[model samples]
Each structure stands twice: as C-alpha cells, then as structure tokens.
Target chain A: MTAKKIHPGAPGLLFLALFLLLSLPISLRAGEALVSGQYLSAVGQDIKMQITVAGPAPGTLIVIQNLPIGTVIDTASPAFNQYDAGKGEVKWLLTHVSPGRYIVNLRLLSPLAPGGISGEIRYKNPANGRLINLPVRP
Target chain B: MDSEKPLAGGIPMVNIDGARIRRIREEKGLTQLYVATVVGVTTDTISRWENRRYPNIKKENALKLAEALEIQLADIIDHGPPTTPPTEAPSLLSGEPSKQEAPEPQPAGQEQAIPLEATAPPTAIRANHRLASRPVVLFGAFLLLTLSCLALFWWSTANDGENQVAAVRTLPAHATPGITFPVVIEVTTTSSRSFSLILKETLPPDCIPAQGKPQFVSQASDPPILKWIGKITGEHTVYCYLAKLRPEAKMDTVHQFTGGVTVRSDDNPSIPVSGTDSLQVSPFHWADSNSDGRIDDEELLSVYETYGGIEGLHFGKKLIEEIWASKGYRFNPETRSYEILQ
Candidate 1:
C-alpha cells in the first residue's frame, strides 16, 4: 500500500490529554499537600498521637493504620473516627481544613502488640475534584 | 463541927482554925520541918502559918498539914477568914504596891475608873484595845474576801480550755473480724481560729489495716500508733480510716481499739484540745454468706459480689496469700468449694 504522510497533531492532543489526566489530582489539590504525625510522649510506648494536616481542603480522610492488637482507640481531638479494634483500622471525616497546619490529637489504651503503624490517608483532592491517597507512618 | 460546912464558893471544904494549928502540931510532937515535908510546902510557909504571920492558909494546904499532923483539918485553919470580906483583908484595890500584906487608902474619886499603873500597864491596855477595834476586824474580813475572789478567777481561767471540746466517733462500735470498719475522728474548736489538727487510732496488736498501713491526715505513720496532722479552722474537723479485724479473733474476747485527736491553734498556742474514743472487735467468719461458719465456692462468689468486686476487695486473693490461705483454706474444683484442708 502507498504511504500517506499524516500530521502528528492528533497524537500530541492525545498525549496532552493523558498528561492532564495524570496531573489532575496534583493541580486540584494545589494549595498544599502535607500531613505529619508524632508521638506525644518520649517513648513510643505511650498511646498518645498528634496528627497535623496543612493546606487545601483534605475533606474526609480515611486513615488505615495497624495498632497493637489489644488497643482500642478510646478518644480523639476534633472527635473520634470509626475504628475497628480487631482490624486496627480507623477512618476520619475531616472538612474545612485551613491553609496552614492544624493538629488532631488521639489517645489509645492497652497496646498489646508492637509492629509498624502504617496508614494511607485518603482525601478528596480539591484540584482534580477526586479522591486521592497519601501514605504515612508515624 | 463548923469546919465540915461548905465554903462561900460552895466548894466542899473544912475551915481550919489558925490558932489551933500550932497547938495541934506541938501536941503531936511532930516537928514543923516534918509537917512541911509531908504537906509539899516550904518550912518557912509552915512557920508563918503556925506563928500566925499569915492570917489564912489555903484550904488544900490546911488539909494536907492536918493529915501530916494526924488531926482534923479544922484544927489548922481559921474559921472566920472564909466569911470575911476580901476587900477588908489584903485588897488589890487599895492602890498599894504591897497590897498582898494589908489594905491601904485610895483617892476618893476612883470608884468607877480603874487605877492605871504609871507605865507598865499601858502596854497591856493598848494591846487589848487594838484587839477589839472594829477597823482591825473589817480589814481582816476584806483581806479574806480579796483572796477568795483571786482564787476563783484563777480556777476559772485554768480550766477554760479544758471545757472546750474535741470529739472522736467510730462507726459500728463493734465490728466482726476479717471485715473492714470505718473510723472517724472529729474536732471542735473552743474559739474561732485556724489551727493544726492530728487524729490517731491505735489498733489492737492482733488487727491489720486494709490499706496496709494507716494513712495520716497529712503526716506519716507512727504505726501501732496511727496518727494524722493538718491545719483546721473554726469548724469541726473529721478524719476517716478503714481497718480490718483479724480473721482469727477469739469468740470469747473482744479486741479494743483506741482513737484520739489533738488540735493546736495558732492564736491560742497555750491551749490545745484533745479527745479519745474506742471500738471493739469480735469473732467473724468470712466467705460464709449463710452464716454457717464455713466457706464454699458459692459462698465465696456471694462474698465477692457483695464486696463490689475488685474495688471493694480489700481481703482478696493477695490477702488470702498473706492472711487466710495458711489457715488451711484451699479451692477445690471438683467440689467447687473453698474448704478447710484436712
């Protein structure tokens, strides 16, 4: 078959669209992307935790973390999350997050086991208008 | 015969005729010295009576002389002397210095007034006057009254603090052994003031405290000597303690415990108030819910439930190890009972 030269414009548009889709979450969540956690006591033995979030509106965060088996998350500042003691999973509903950093304090009791306390913070990215996940370990 | 009559003073007496005294003595052939020795008088006095130098002799002496002479008392005495006026004889009213010898003339106007000695008698008169004066009697009475008032004041003040009261109270004046009892001590102030307070209860030697040791109101334990120290005010202060009677308490005897409190006020340091109270302990069996004097698993569970589980479990498992276990108590699973081991 005889080759016909076609302009590469359509491919560029496709690449741009893919780029926009990939970068959508970052743009929508523009103001800031920050989350941090720290143990309120000197040793990690203490069950008190303080979590801070900065910028944009990270509305309704779902935090999934493993706690010592026997521990029950008894109390939290800004109020409590839906927590499952057996699964060591906790979910928080955060709204109207300010542009700067703010803290949420948490307390648990009777920590029976010791292991990595890892969690993914899921929030609605304001830039892409879609839910996004950020990983954290404190 | 007249010598036998009573004298003018109505004393039973015999009048001795002085004139017959010498005649009788000479007739007896008794020497005056011998008569004087028997009569317990000087020989000079005997001679004066026999010679009539003394017109009258005492009736007692007359009787003694007559007895010595072996004659009647009337033989030695003058019968006329007892009836004679004493003023006409040797009268002291005559104002003569030697009035013992005979009467003398006195000034005419001295009938009502007494004759005053120039110097010697004034001292006696002044002393007599001072004793009867109204001023001296009044002064003595006033001094006695003042001393009485001062003593009354001292007595009231000395006992004022004692009358102010602090008190102690114990719940269930009598308690059963192996059970805990509440003890309270109260203090009331004499005056409105801030003060330091201390409450103490001395447990009987056989008893143990549920809390391990007595916790003082503010201070440390003196043990067997339980005590407390703190500050207080005008209101009454109360202190509390929980103690357990020994499980092995004897049924026949009662254990005595004493409690006391002392209060020292800042304003009134000199006066401190203290009070004391007592409690008694008798035999009791634990884990015996039905009062059967024995323990079964059902009874143990019943007791645990009654004691409010862990919070009220003063004599729990730890206490079993320390106190009750050695007394032959063991848990039997098959029987489901806590029994006294054979």
Candidate 2:
C-alpha cells in the first residue's frame, strides 16, 4: 500500500488565505460638491445670471463672475464684495456658508455674449486649509 | 435529532448514526433478516441503515426501526459519533441535545475550529492531516497573527499609512506676528464605519491657536496643542482655525506643524498625520500655491476653484489675477505680502 505524503506548509497556506480575505478594501462614496451657473433669461438689455453652490457651510467660500468688459452691471442679489469693471470681475465673498444651495444673482447690463460669463468657486477645506478651485459649470 | 439546518418542508427524515443500531442488533443476537422483516423493509435497506450508507431515512421508518429494536428514535440518529455510552432506556427525540450541546469527544481526523481547513482539497487534507495536526495549526495561526501585526506596524511607521484620511495641513509661506495664519487640517475618510477619532496636533512652539478646545487630551502641553474629537460619518469634513506666531517668532524663520490621529476602537489604530515628522514652512500666498512669483494660468484657475469663494482672507482674488497678469512677483519683507512686479 502506498502512503500519502504530508506537505509541511499546508497549515501556513491555509492561514495566509484567511488573512488576505480580511484585508480587501471596501468601496463607498457618499459625499459631493458642485458649483454651477445658469443664464435664466434676459430683459431688454438686462441679462440674468444665477450661481449656485451645494456643499458644507463650515468655512468661507469665494465665487467670481467674469463678464465682458463692456457689459454694464446693474446689481447683485447676494451683493458682490468687489467689482473691477476694467477686468469685468464681479466677486462674491460668501461667508459661513451653510449646508445646501447658496445662490448669487446678477443682473448684467446687456444680452449675454456667447462666452460672456466664465467663473469658478474657491473653497478652503476647513479640515486641511487646502484650497480647492472648481469651475462654475454652464 | 433534527439538524439545526432548515429543511425544504419535504417528508421528515433524520441522519442515523448506525453504530448504536449495530451494537443493539448484535447484543440481541438478531439477524438482519429478522430486523428487516419486523421493520417491513428488505434486508439490503436494513444493511444500508446499519452501515450508515443510507444515513438519512424517513422519520416514520426510523420510528418503526426503533420499535423493532425496542429503542427510541434519538438512539440511532446521527449526532456525529458517540461521546457517551447509550442510556439504560433509550430516550425519545425530545431528549436529544443538538450536536453542539452534546459532549464532543472528537477523534484526530477533523478540526472543528479553523474554517480555512475546510477549504483544503481532499488530497491536501490527507496531507495536512499529519502536518496540520492541532499543535501545528495552533502555532501557525499564532505566528500568522504576530506577522500580520508586525506588517501593520511597519506600514504605519513607513508612511503614516494615510489609509484612514488623506489629510493635509495648510500653512502660509510664513507666520506674521499680530496676524493669525490659518491652521487647516482637511481629513477625508476612506472608510465608512461609524467611530470617533481624536486629532492631536503639535504646533510649533512659536505659535498659539487663536481659539479652540482640548489643546491637550490632559493638561495644556508645552508646545500649544490642537485637539479635536470627530464622530466620523461618511462625509467630506474640514477642521480649520487660525493661529498666530508668538512674539518671539523671528522674521524669515520657519517652524514645523506635526500631529497624530487616534481611532477609538478595539484595535485602537493610531495613524500619525502623514509627513508630519517635519514640514516646510513655505512662504507664499494662499493664492500663489506653488510659491512662484507668478500665479500662472493653471494656479490661478486652481485658486479660483479652491479659494475663489472662500471668505475671511485679507488677501483679495483681484490681486491674484493681477499677479497672473503680471510678469512675476516678489515678497517685500517690510510689507509681509507679495507684490506684482508691474
């Protein structure tokens, strides 16, 4: 009768397999940040621009609207902090931004140019003061 | 004698151990024919039942066999071999304890603990039957545990294994007295299990937090401390505050920020804030992230995304734009701010 050969490392192999199973990564993603802008409509020469932000309100969040140099600025709902007409930059310094939609309304002087409105959102992640800049979407 | 595993609502059947049946039949000097005839089965079926080849049989058939053997249904029900001798009067199935509840006198053939052993191939099991004997399996398991612990220790030591949080500290190019710079630690959780973690940050001795709590887990420590307890939910959370340099902090001098994060749990995994052993105090604008004299197109665009709408910074976004439009810039020590070289 032939005898079975016992491999010495069998027990060790069994345990290594068990440990590998425990260390596999778990996948999940349930958080988000979005900055967007829309041209609602236009009156005789007054165009409307709406900016919205959906995120945390823990830190100061900055948004800027770069309009055409010749465009006239009527007013802003959540009033802008600065307006440099030479550069056509309408800036809003929104502080203590709470969770949910934060909107900034702008009444531009004329019908929007094809590429007239271009802007972005700058946020200082409070946890790690690292700055994240996201473009304001169309 | 019913197995704990759920059944499909088919006819009731049970696993017969057969060892007790054989012993009872032999003791009574009863031939297989007599027992088969009494139970109204062929001799072959009774033989199969005696050898456990037909381990599971109809519950009614089992009851008939018990009556023929002058025993109870539990007597021949398979509970995986005997641990104790049969009782004087065989009890009914109601008296039968579960396989787990019954005293187990296991032989050397199978392992009850390590589930991994069950996955071994038949040939491998035969091979490990000798090599993976109880003592060897126990030692291997212990060694595996020790090695796993050592590997985790080495990984955390090597890179701070930012496996829990990819956190970064926001430091201004330099610290200015009477002016508080931001101490921002942004942590993004990679795991979703709910638990609390305490972040302990050791600031440079030359600085103190503008305002916050539990600077120390205990007493206020020598180097001003920053302690934050966070109940982590799956979210993009940020921890930020302001800190100013001490009066003694000299111009052009740099101080490092360091700290550790401890997760409260059974394993108590503690991850040092990655790269905190030392850090460079880069002198640059929150806008000129790269510390270059110019906020080039890309950097300015990034600034717009990260800090464009952030409030409370004395520095203006227009200045960053001017810097972007300029040839370059320089830090005027007297002003403690960067200037565009128009």
Candidate 3:
C-alpha cells in the first residue's frame, strides 16, 4: 500500500490548537455566580451580617475583605472555615458543592462609630482563580 | 343713651323704651300672640321687640303696634318736644290737609316749612332707633350654655375612664412556634397626674420573655404574668417582652395573652383597664414539615410549591424562609436540601 501523503504543518497546527485551548479563560467557560452581603444588626457590641450566594459555586473560595475598622469575627456565632484577622478577611472554602444557593450568618464584634459602617465581599472562582467583589452598603 | 348706639330717625335722635311697650301691653291685658296677630306678625317678633333684641321696627308696624295696644300714635312715640305742629303729624297720617286752611303765598326763595321727620315715613324713624339693650343678659346666657357644655364633657369623659387614664395592648396576630415576637403596651392620660402605674402582661403557658430585667421593675407571676410597677406622671409605654413562643405550644389554635394596667393617683385610686390579644401558632413548621426538626428535600419541594416556585423566597414568601433561617437551615436549591453550617 502506498504511504498516505504527509502534511508537514499538521503537527504544528495541532500544537497551536492545544495552546489556545489551555490558555482560554476559566471564567469564560464557567457559569456566572453572584454574592451578596448585608449588615443586619448590632448585638450588644457585636455586629451581625447575613451573606448569600446564588448559582452553581462548587469548589469556590468566598472571602469577605477590608472589613470596617475595629471589627473582628465573633466566636460566639458560627466560625468561618478560614480567617486572616490581620488582613481583615474571613474566608469560606466549599468543596464538592452542587449548583444551588447558599447563605451564611456571621456575627462580628466591633467598636462601631455612631452612625454606621460599610464593607465588601469577594467570590473567588476555583476554576479560573478570578475574584468578584460585592459591596456591603450601610 | 350711649352715642355708640345707632340713632333714631330724626334731626334729634331718641332712644325707645322697650319696657314701656311691655308695661302698656300688660296694662291692656293683651297677650303677645294677640298683639302679633293684630300686627300681622309672629309672637316671636313681638317678644323680640319687647326684649329689645331688634333695636328698630318699621313705622307702619309701630303704628299697628300702637293700635293693637289701643293707644294713639303720639302716645306710643316718646318725642321729647314738638318742633313742628302736631297737626302736621296728623295731616301726614291722614294724607290730607284741614278743610278750613287756605293756601298762603310766600316771598320768592321762601319755601313752605315742614320738619323732615314729619314728612319722612314712620318706618324711617323706627329703623333709626338702634340700640340693642340687655347685651349683658345675652352674654350671660351664652356663658351659662358654654359652662354647661364643658361640665357635660368633663362628666362624660371622666365617667368613661377617658379623662384620667387609658391603656392599650398590641401583639402579632400570628406567629410560628418557637418564634420570638414583640408585645407592646401603651398608657396615656389627659392630666399630668403623678401616680403609681402597674402594667401586667399575662403571657400564654409556654411563652417566655426574651429579655431579662427590663428598665422598669419587672416581676414574673404564675400563668406567666410579666409585671412592671412604676410611677408615671402623664403618658407611658411598656414594650415588656420579645416573647419566644415555645415549640410545645398548641399548634393551629389561637392562644390569648391578657394585659391589665392600673393607675393610682393622689386623687383617684384603682383606675384599672384590661385588654386581650391573641397569636395563633402556624399549623405546620416550615422546614420541619413532619416536625422532625430537620428540613428534608421533600419538605423543601413542598415549600417551593407553596411559594410559587420562586427561589430566594422573599416578601410574602419570607415567613417560612425566616423561620428556617432562625433554625440555622440554609437552603440549597441545587441539591434541594437545607444544610446546617456552623
């Protein structure tokens, strides 16, 4: 049998395709997810909040960063999976979560000012390692 | 006569004596109704004239009044002096001159002299007589009526327990078992009276006060009476308890909470008012549909169906969601299960 005609650029074309596929942004491939945070009440000297997450967020890292001054996580209530007190960040790492909604309640103790305080929450996509920030209004 | 009073119709004004009419009518033994009939007017007109409520009357009516009194017109009129001949007055009334009188010619620019009051209608004279006597009496009558109304108001309000003290109680009409809700009591008083006020809220059997040792003197009595004893001067409000309804409370049945408030002032004691409010425990627990104290996927689906299949249930749909959240159950629509994350 005669040998099949060899295309010289076939291997090069295959390598270029592989490079493009690997370099594609993970966020472009993943479904969009949302994160919302609210400061609920002042319990004695402690502050309370209810945070919500909507969409399929499996293997995601949820971070609440840049908290208002003089505030820290309260041990009396539910504890976060990971927290960096120096960075003012509270992190929750979810593994093997299904496509659904989730909510978390956190109580923080702070020497709050007279009027009110504000903060933000960030959602880290495990696939592309992208951070989405959600503001927490007064 | 007060010059401030309006003048009678004449070059020289006069004040009519209302008492003279009463005296003359009495002397003639004439009833006001009879006189009014003769004058073609209501008895009230005659009464008003005698009372001096109307300062003036028409001269025609006055003449009729004199005839009804069986008196001459001049006798009824209190003219101080006649500047003109009385014969002229009669001539004016008869609308004719005396037959014996002859016309006299006067010098050029010399006019026949006649008093304007004599030529003017008696109606004009009556309108000019303008003082309303007995204003003091009218003012006294009005004052008496006003005082009577104020007394009546005071008596009615005091008798109805409105003038002294009033109290009201309010509570949520419906609540889920083991939920915490507010109970409010308000007391008001019209007078700033210093008194010892006691507010007693009788909670249901399984209810408990969420807060301890409130600002007021608090006490717990059997049948769960939460009592506050303090001295109040005017108005006060007592938000006694954020009461947590026990899970053991009877489901689907309304439970009544009664409240009694009493005020003892320096003048009055034992002013007590009582009111009642009720709360019904929801028939089914939201997350624990089977009362298993945990949310199963089936129960979650049932909740979704009941809430119109909307996710992130809110507004009218937040009742069950709030209860479940209170129990530390975060719903996962993907797996359709509620997980307790610490």
Candidate 4:
C-alpha cells in the first residue's frame, strides 16, 4: 500500500484566505444591490419600464428613488412587481410623467444580505420609445 | 417516406434535403407556398421531410428531389439518432405516428403556418394581439372607476342647498340738513338658489317704504328704487329682508337686510352777533382779506385791515347778508341793511 501525502495546514489556511477576500468586497459595497434594465416605451401614450437584477436574492425590497421635481407617482394606477430570479424580468408602469428629462434610480434592499444593487434608467419621449443615456453623479 | 413524395397537380414542392431545404427557404425569402408551388406536392409534405417528419425519404427519390432543388442529398437526409418521442402525445390528434407526426401542422418550407382561409380575420386577429399585449387593461379600468367616484363627490358638494345675500350701503357727499340724501344699497346674491326681497324701515310716521309693507317691486329683476325724505334728524336703522316664498306658494320667509344712517337736526343754535358803530365804514361790511374769495377769509381771520390803510377801525362782519332768504330779502344801499322786499 502506498502512503498518501497531505499538506498539514492547507485546508484551514485556504478557508481563512477565502474568508478574508470575500469580506473586503462586502465591506466596500454595502446596503444595496446593483441593478440594470431597459426602459421600454408603450405603443400608446405613456412610457413603460422593464427592470432586471443580475443576482437577486429572495425577500429583497426594491424602490425607485430620485424622481424629478413635480413628477408625481400615479398612485391611481401603479404597476410594480418582482420577477422570478431565474426568469430575469420585472415590470413597472408610470403614467402622465409629462415631457422632460428624469433620472430613475432602482434600489434593492435585503434584510439578511450584506450588500445590494442600484442602477439608473433615463426616459425620453416623442420619438416613439427612444432610450437616452443619463450621466451618473459621483 | 412514401407519403413525403410530391403529388402531381398539387402545390409545387421543393425537393431539397432537410439541410438544403432550410438553407434555400431562408435564401429565397419565399414562404412554404412558394416552394410548394415550384414542386408538385402539399406544403405539409415539404414541411414534414425538411423538419425530418419521416424516418427517411426513399434514398433514390431523396436524391432526385435534392438534384431538382440543387442541394446535397446527405444534408437533407439527417442520419443522426431519431428525436425522442414527446412524453405525452397531445390528445387532439389520434392514430398519427407518435414521433414522426408534426407536433403542430406546418407547411413545407415554413416552420409553422396557418392557411390564410382558415386563419382569423385580420381585424379580429389584430384586436386579439393588441388585447394580449396590453396586460394593464384591468388597471386602466380600475383607474377610471376611481376617477368617477371623485367626480361624484365634487358634484354632490357643489349642489348643497344654501342661499346667501349680501347688502352694502353708500351715502352721497354734501347732504343738506333736514333734507334727504340719496343712500344707495347694493345687494348681491351669492348662492346658487334664488330668493325674493322684503325691505322694512323704522320710519317716524313720515318715512315709509315709498310704497307699503310687503312691496313686490324690489323682487323684480332690477334693483328697486326708494327715496327716503328726512323728517326728524338723528341715527335711524332700516331693516330689510328677502321674503323668499316658494314658487306658486305664499309664505313670508324674511331674510333681514339692516342698515343705519346719521341725520343732523336743525335745532342746533347759531352764533350770537353784536354790531359795532364805525364811522366812515366801507359800504361792504364783509371784505376778503386775501381778496381771493367773496367772504371765506372773514371766518379765518379775526382782525381785518382796510385796503384804504385805515387802522383801529372795527367792523362786525356777518357771513349771511339776510336771515330770511325764503321770505325774500334785498340789499338796500340807502339804509345800508337787508330788509324784507314784501
């Protein structure tokens, strides 16, 4: 029988190294998840929005922040939902947003998770459903 | 395989093998009908073989079809293992080949096609397509319902049963003592409903409503005109109301209109006067010191200097030339006094 060779402190040392590396990124980015999606335009009057998260965990709360002034949330008809994590599509509807430039921030929150995601979408009108680029502030 | 062969007088079919058929169909930019008409076969047969509907097309005919369609025979005849049969064959079709039959009936070069005649009318199909795309239709209906409720609430509040009337009084300038001055009161209705007018005054037997109690003239479309002649001068309050009676019914529902005015009595005493004897006095007793007005300066200045430079000469100047103008008075140069003409 051949004797098996094993490194004495390899497993414990490897786990410690991984734990340290993971902790660094989590500390750097905390409180919110990073999200990205497309702003889809409807065939009718108002514009529609579709958002997706890259790796969304269960029980994550999402909120849209940083709306333009005088832009009211149409609570009369608010459409928002979370998609299956594997499916990768969530949709929200906003009506009578008026004609102007706006920056919509998508924020994600989790009770147990260390970090979350946030993304921005710009909405424009008149040219049917054109997606314009929005400059992000530092 | 035999059923996959093209039939005569039927729609023309493309004889290319599976691979070549797919390639040519995509390149020609023609639908399954185009290929079906080019060769003599049903579009279904073309779809079946191209999609590998049969185990295999006979080797000889497969080659003939490939040559006609100008494609390699092997590409059309896939030699790979047969696709596994679906777990459950759809219940709709019976006795059809379990694995080889088309899962959905499709045309020859077309992956999935419905005959134009069998398909829904264009208008109905378009409506259905639009309806399916709009998943927010229910939300829109709910929003309309909420708006209607709000409109109803506004309508109910606007029609609340209440009527209001307002009155304001204005007096004319420079009114004569013991004489009536025009006092105009503007009345306006501030309610959606309409009412009638009832004006009552505390008159001293002398002053009346110009007409009588329950006067109907004020209720007319235009504001009623009334003139009050002063009898006794002091403060007097006039009470008026809008006597709103239901249409075609007689009930005096008085809406009070109250106002007051101050009148000066003629019993106030006048200043007493005494005459001073002045020798070589000017014929005109009252003289204008500023010489700008008739006699306004006499009341302002107590002492007066004559234009002749005479000093220490006093004269009692009377503002009124005669006390009884109604009894007729005329100035007499000889007597140097005003006396009754009669």
**Judged by DockQ, which candidate is best?**
2
Query: Which digits, one per residue and each the tens of the lDDT, describe model 3 over residues A7-105?
Result: 999999999988788766554445354555666653335556566665544234343434454456666344564454555555443323445544445
Alpha-carbon runs more than 4 Å astray in model 4: A1-138, B1-20, B82-342
Per-residue lDDT tens digits of candidate 1, residues B258-321? 6654443212222222333434543333333344434433333233332322233244444322
lDDT of 3 by residue, B261-330 (tens): 5443223323344444777776333335565554433343333333322232231334443343334454
Per-model TM-score, in order, reads: 0.25, 0.41, 0.28, 0.15
Q: Per-residue lDDT for B74-104 in model 4, tens only? A: 5565445544222111233433564544487
Which ranges of candidate 3 are over 4 A from the true structure? A1-138, B1-162, B212-218, B266-276, B283-342
Candidates in descending TM-score order? 2, 3, 1, 4
Summarize candidate 2's per-residue lDDT along B1-342 as a digit string, tens digits.
343222366566666767689889777655665566445577667765665544666677788788667688777778774333332122254344445456868887576466776887989888778775878889999999999999989776534423656566655555345445555566667666554565667877877676442232221446877767665677545565567666556665767778666654323344666543332333455456566666654565445445434345433556666676566787665666566776
Q: Give the TM-score of candidate 1.
A: 0.25
lDDT tens per residue, model 1, A48-133: 44557665544434444556555666566656444556666655544344455444445665433344465556555545545455
The DockQ-derived docking category for candidate 4 is: incorrect
Tell me how candidate 1 scores on lDDT.
Answer: 0.52
What's the ranking of the predictions by DockQ, best on top?
Answer: 2, 3, 1, 4
lDDT scores in order = 0.52, 0.60, 0.53, 0.34
lDDT tens digits by residue: candidate 2, A37-134? 56564333444555565554434556777777867877777877667778887776665556556667777656675655667777655444456576
